[model samples]
Target: MAKKPKSDPNYKVIAENRRARHDYAIDEDLEVGIVLMGSEVKSLREGGANIAESYAAVEEGELWLVNGRIAPYAQAKTWGHEERRKRKLLASKRELARLWNATQRKGMTLVPLVLYFNHKGLAKMKIGIAKGKKHHDKRADAAKQDWNRQKARLLRDKG
Candidate 1:
């Protein structure tokens, strides 16, 4: 999870894919830089972005963020960026190789988890290496959560 720093004004989440965790079992997550245009950055600063339907992919030896949407900046009408363009994600060569191997050989997915600006105000994204969860898995998770809640309530009442 992306932790927001209490004292940093620039540390803000632009967009988050809340359903990613519910649909996928994340093995690991990595933060990587995103290549954004000026207009896209402006839009993101205004909280005009969505990662709900976005994903990451290691393509042709490079990482790409696909289907991410950054609403066009109204002020940059002449030079606005495409809302749903494929953006390049920057990561170390070693990390890229590992991600590629996980996706290709291990059959894992690269799911976009969160899009945010770091403490220094640079835009970054968290990508999760995950496997898809089945319907039964979701149900079991819900049941477990319910049981925990009930157990907590019972202990509280007994005390």
Candidate 2:
């Protein structure tokens, strides 16, 4: 008989940069596919990733994801591709146009929220359309988050 897969005690956190939430006011999010090199894809599957400094840009009618890093595969040789080269992203024509329009607005930005494998075992990126937060806005968000945390803690204690 075939053996079943073992459950991990801890949920695997492939990778994440928590700063994205604190830096921008996300307006919307879309899950998109990325074009990757051989080594890059292997690195991503191994949970070798970094997205803190990554963002999306559109140029010449093509969408690109820049600043995202997937480490080189261990067995890869000197011919390995660039670690943080701008990678192409796939989206529908309408979606791409909408994103382009939103990006033209001042202070509006495209930020990568998360990178993970989907049910089909393909890598996907969740990109968020966000607006930059001003100093006052940041302070307000921080305060709100603090209040929420306190509320949760108090409720837990009472329970």
Most TM-score-accurate candidate: 1
Model 1, stretches more than 4 Å misplaced? Answer: none
| Model 1 lDDT tens row, 65-155 | 9999999899998888899989999999999999999998555899999999999999999999999999999999999999999999999
> Per-residue alpha-carbon lDDT of model 2 for 9-114, expressed as tens digits?
3223345656877899889988888898888877877888998998899889988999888888887787677888999999999999999999999999898887
- Candidate 2: clashing pairs of residues: none
Candidate 2 local Cα displacement, residue 77, angstroms: 0.6
TM-scores, one per candidate: 0.97, 0.85
Q: CA shift at 59, candidate 2, in angstroms?
A: 0.7
Clashes (backbone N, CA, C under 3 Å), per candidate, total: 0, 0
Model 1 C-alpha RMSD to native: 1.0
Candidate 1 displacement at residue 76 in angstroms: 0.5
